[model samples]
Target: MAEEKSNKKTNIGEVVSDKMDKTVVVAVERKTQHSLYKRVIKRTSKFKAHDENNECNEGDIVKIVETRPISKQKSWKVEEIIRKAK
Candidate 1:
């Protein structure tokens, strides 16, 4: 049989903090239109993701995937480092 792929939730965001041991904070931004005014607005959500190798750095672009909870606030893990910090 062919191998199966898991349908996990994923998000691409920028690393806002890499101060924690084996973890990093990523800020995901999305744009949505206001319900009443129809005005576009930018919204940001921060997620604490596991960086097992501690390779991610602040300001780096990364892709994270949802997984079993690792902590109170960390249910996501770094899937890949999209771009390194300059």
Candidate 2:
């Protein structure tokens, strides 16, 4: 069970929204190179993560882990706050 939990997908991203109760929106950005153009491009993905303590705020950096669906849109949970918002 512990090993299976350890294999869950995780993402480090900045919290984009924290308006929902016990939920926060995290935007994870990644850089990918254009196959033909050979240019690096930035891509962002937003995820709704469960924040049991409501400790996250907009602009805060947080680590989120995949978990069982807690809501219709939330399948991720906040693991920890990496950085606080200024």
Candidate 3:
């Protein structure tokens, strides 16, 4: 098998809003265990990713990849538009 490519991995999130031009807001949520308490906690963060074209819309699940800074607070790019909003 060919060597698998490994780059900066990113979590998939739903597109909460895509009103901004060339920019989209993705909501990524993850569960982590507390170091001492050992209790799982749900943490969510909104990421501003660069979308070259206006291809994604609200409620769409998409994938984004980490990349060099394209603008202020923008270090990620949309990789693909996975699913459309239901």
Candidate 4:
């Protein structure tokens, strides 16, 4: 039998902060319709992602993938930089 490998979860978001060494905070926003109000709403979530080289900067669009916990608040790592910050 062959072993199965599950795919990790990924998210595309903007880097909100990168003041920490080798770490960046990403803000992922999503649009969804309210269950009761039936109105579209924008939801934002903050995630702590590991940046091995600390190349991310504020306002940069990046992709993050789930991984083994590296710290108390970091369970995700920056996969790639989608867009550079202006």
Task: Name the candidate that leads on lDDT.
Answer: 1
Worst 10 residues of 4 by lDDT: 2-11
- lDDT of the structure predicted as candidate 1: 0.98
What TM-scores do the predictions have? 0.93, 0.91, 0.87, 0.91
Clashes of each: 0, 0, 0, 0
Better model by TM-score: candidate 2 vs candidate 3? 2
Q: Model 3: how far is 65 from its true place, Å? A: 0.1
Instruction: Please report the candidate that would top TM-score against the real structure.
Output: 1
In order, the Cα lDDT scores of the candidates are: 0.98, 0.95, 0.92, 0.97
After superposition, candidate 1 runs with Cα above 4 Å error? 1-5
* Candidate 3 CA-lDDT value: 0.92
After TM-score superposition, the amount by which residue 35's alpha carbon in candidate 2 deviates from its true location, in angstroms, is 1.8
Poorly placed runs, candidate 4 (over 4 Å): 1-6
**Tens digit per residue, CA lDDT, model 1, 1-86:** 99889799999999999999999999999999999999999999999999999999999999999999999999999999999999
